[model samples]
Target: MHNAINESYLGERYSEWSLDSDSTIETPNKNQAPWGLENISPIFRAYENSIWQNHVAAMWSHLEARYNITSNDSCGTHVHISLIEGYSLSALKRICQSIIYFEPAFEAILPRARLGNEYARSNWLDNPNFGYKRLSRRESMVVIEKCTSVRELVLLTPTTISSLGGISSISLKPLKEPLNFVVVQQARLSAMSLYKISKIPATVGGLKWFIEAAQLPQQPGLFDTRYINLLLDSVGPKLTREPKPMGKLSPDKLRKLQTKKDEDKRKNVMLAKISQPPYWG
Candidate 1:
C-alpha cells in the first residue's frame, strides 16, 4: 500500500527506499528538516495501518491538487523521504484512539463559549483569569441564590466560586417543578484543582465555583449521587428524617412519563429532520 501511494504521488522523485533501524537523515545544511523527516522510522508501517494510510493518502492528494504539482520528476535530484523507526502497533492504535476520544470532547467544550447564555458568554471572554476575577466570594453566593434554573446555575458556577478544598456544608430542599430536589452544597477548594482535577464539578457546578467550594466527594463519580453521599456521610447524621423506602412509581405514572418522553423524542426528531436547502427555481 505504501509503495502504491509512493508510486502514484512520488513517482521518479521517490528515490530508492532505504529501510533502517534508528537512523536520522540530515539536510544539506546539516540542520534538521522542519517535518522531522529524519525521524521516519520503519516501525511506522504498523503506525500507518490502513486507516492512517488512507488519511495520509488523502492529505497527499489534497496537497498535490492544490499546488498543481505532478508525480513526475519536476526536479532532477531524488527527494529524500524519512520515516521514523521503533513504535509498536499498540502504541499507534492508542494514538488513534486518543484522537477519536479527544475530538468529541474538544467539539463539546470548544463551542460552549459560543452559547447564547450571558454567563457562558462572559465566562468565555479572553481574560487572563478566564472571567473568575470578576466576582468575590460573597458575590458568587449571591449569584448562585439568584439563579432560577439549572442551566443558569451551571453557567454561574464557574464564575462564582474559586475551588472545592473540602466539604463545608450540604443542604437539600424539595423542589416543585422539573426536578424533585435542589441540593446546595458549599466547599473550600482551589481554582486550579477544580478546573483541572475534577470533571464532575467542572461540568455540573462550574469550574470556578468547584475550586472555591470546600465541600466535595473524595471518591470520583457523578455529581448528584456523589454529592448526596458526601452529605450523608458528613452531614446526614445530623438530619432528622427517618429513611423512607425508596419510592416506587405506580404503573400509570410510569406509563404517562414514558409517553411524555416518547413525544419529546418525536418532536426532536422532526425538528432535526427539517432542513433548508437553496432552491435556484
Candidate 2:
C-alpha cells in the first residue's frame, strides 16, 4: 500500500520522515470499507486547493483505474482542515463557537447513518444517557469567549481515546470531562505558544452566507428531517445543567502556563553543557 501510494506522488511519505505512525495513512474499519477485497487507505499531507486537485485527486484516480475501488454506506471520508498557518486566539474561539452554534443546521444535510454516529458525535447535543450537558449558542460562546490561549481553545473540542492496539484501525472512544482530565493535562503540557497572526475574516455573515454558497435555497421550515431531533434526542439537553468552563485556570494562571519548549529550556541548556567535554582549566 505504501509503495503504491508513494508511486503516485513526488514528495516523501510522512512515514518516511516521521516516527509517529499515527500521522500516516490508516486502514479503515473492516466493517465499513469495501468487502471481499483488502482495503488500503493512503492519507496525504495537507495541500492547497490546486495541489489537492493535481496530486491528491490524481492519486485517487490512479487507484480507481488500477483497482476496482468502491464505496458503500459504511464508508465515509474525513476531511481535516489544516492549521499550517494556525489561527488567532479570537479566530479559533469563533470557529469553535460557530461549529457548536451551527451544528444542527450542518447535521441537517448529512446522510441518515451520520446523524448520531458514535464515531463522530454531536458536540452541541448533550445526551444525558451518555452523560453530558448541551450548550446553548450564548452558553457555548461564553465558553469559547473566555479562552485566553490555544490550549484552552483546543480543549473545547471532543476528547477521544485511541482504539486498542494500533493507528491503522479507525476506532476511538469519546471521553467527557473529569474522565478526560489526563488528556487535558497532557495537552496543556504540550501547548503551543500563542502568537498573533493576520486578521481573521469576519464570521458575522454567519450561516446565511454559508447556505447561499452551498446553493441551498431558503425554505419556510427546517429541513424535513426534524424527526432526527426527536429520534436522537439531539434537539438540546433536556435536563438542565451548567456549562462548564473548558479550563479551570484563571486568566492570571493561564498566562503563567508556558509553552513546552520554554518550560524545558533550562534543563535543555544544562544537558547541552553536560554533554560537552569539561574545560581543560
Candidate 3:
C-alpha cells in the first residue's frame, strides 16, 4: 500500500502517510514495519488550507477514484480546528458550557456507532471522577460556570482511556464537531500553572522545563505545532520579534524612540517592584 500510494498522481504528498499501530483498519498485506506494528493504518500528516476544496476535498476525490476503498464500522472522520489567534479563557469556558447544555442534541444526530464509542465518550455520562449524574440542569451549569481556570474546567470534564493504556485527557475522536476539549483545556492549564509558579521563568523557554517538572503527560504528537497544546509555546517566540511600523518614522528616530520607551518601561517596572509591601520574616 505504501508503494502503491507513493507511485500515484498525488504520490509526492502521500509520502507523509505512515502506518499507525492504534488504527483498527483491516489490510490484506501483513508486511510489518521494523517496529513490528501491523501496517494497516496509513495515517496522513496534519494539514491546513485556507480553502477546503483545494486540499482535503481534492485528495479525498483522488483516493476514492483510484483505490478500492470501503468504509466500515471503524471508519470515522476527525476535523481539527487551528485558531489563528488561539482560544481565550472566556471563550473556552463558554464553549464547554454550551457543549454540556446541548450534548443531547448533538448525540441525537450522530450515528448509533458513535454513541458508546470508547474513543469519544460523552462528557455528560456518569463518572466517579465527576458526579454529574445526580446534578440538576441548573446545578450542572453552576458547576461548569464556576470554574475559574482551565484546570478547574478539565477536572469537571470526563476523560477516556486509550487502547494503548494511556490516559487520554483529550480524546481525538469527535462525531461531527471533531472538537477535543482535553487538548485545549490541558494547554491552558499548563499556561496558567506556569503563570502561578514564581520559580518557573515567565517565558516560552521555561515552559518545556516546567512541563517536565510538573510530570504532565508528554505525548510525542500531542505537543507538536499542529496541536493546540503548544499554542502558548508557539506564540512566545513570535512575541519577541519587532512589530512593523505603521506610522511615519525615520530609522534613526525609531531607534531613539524605542530606546527611550525601553528605559521608561524598565524604570516603571523597577518602581513598581519597589512599591510592593515588604514581607515580614
User: Largest lDDT belongs to which candidate?
Assistant: 3
What lDDT is reached at residue 29 by model 1?
Answer: 40
Local accuracy of candidate 1 as per-residue lDDT tens digits, 1-281: 12221112232322222211111222334343321121111111212112323333454465457644322111111111112342233332222222211222212332222222211122222112322355432333344345555554444443222111001111112111111011222122112221233343223223223323534333221123333333234332222211111124468545644664454443322122122221110
User: Against the unseen true structure, what C-alpha lDDT does each candidate score?
Assistant: 0.26, 0.34, 0.38
Clashes (N, CA, C under 3 Å) per candidate: 29, 0, 0
TM-score of each: 0.16, 0.44, 0.43
Residue 148, candidate 1: Cα error in Å is 11
Model 2, which residues run further than 4 Å from truth? 1-12, 15-49, 126-131, 159-208, 211-281
List the candidate numbers ranked by lDDT, top first.
3, 2, 1
Write candidate 2's Cα lDDT for 206-257 as tens digits: 2333323333222212222122223223323322222222224456434433
Tens-digit per-residue lDDT, 1-281, candidate 3: 34222122222322222322323333445465322121221222222222222333444465568855444454444433334356665666555543433344334333455444443454444333333366643356567667788776666664422121112222233222212233433443444321144454424444334344444453433432223333334344212211111224468556654664454343322233223332211
Look at candidate 2 and tell me the lDDT of residue 108: 43
Task: Give residue 138's lDDT in candidate 1 (0 to 100).
Answer: 30
lDDT value for model 3: 0.38
Q: Which scores greater on lDDT, model 2 or model 3?
A: 3
Q: Which 10 consecutive residues of model 2 have the lowest summed lDDT?
A: 160-169
Model 1 deviation from the true structure expressed as Cα RMSD, one decimal place:
25.9
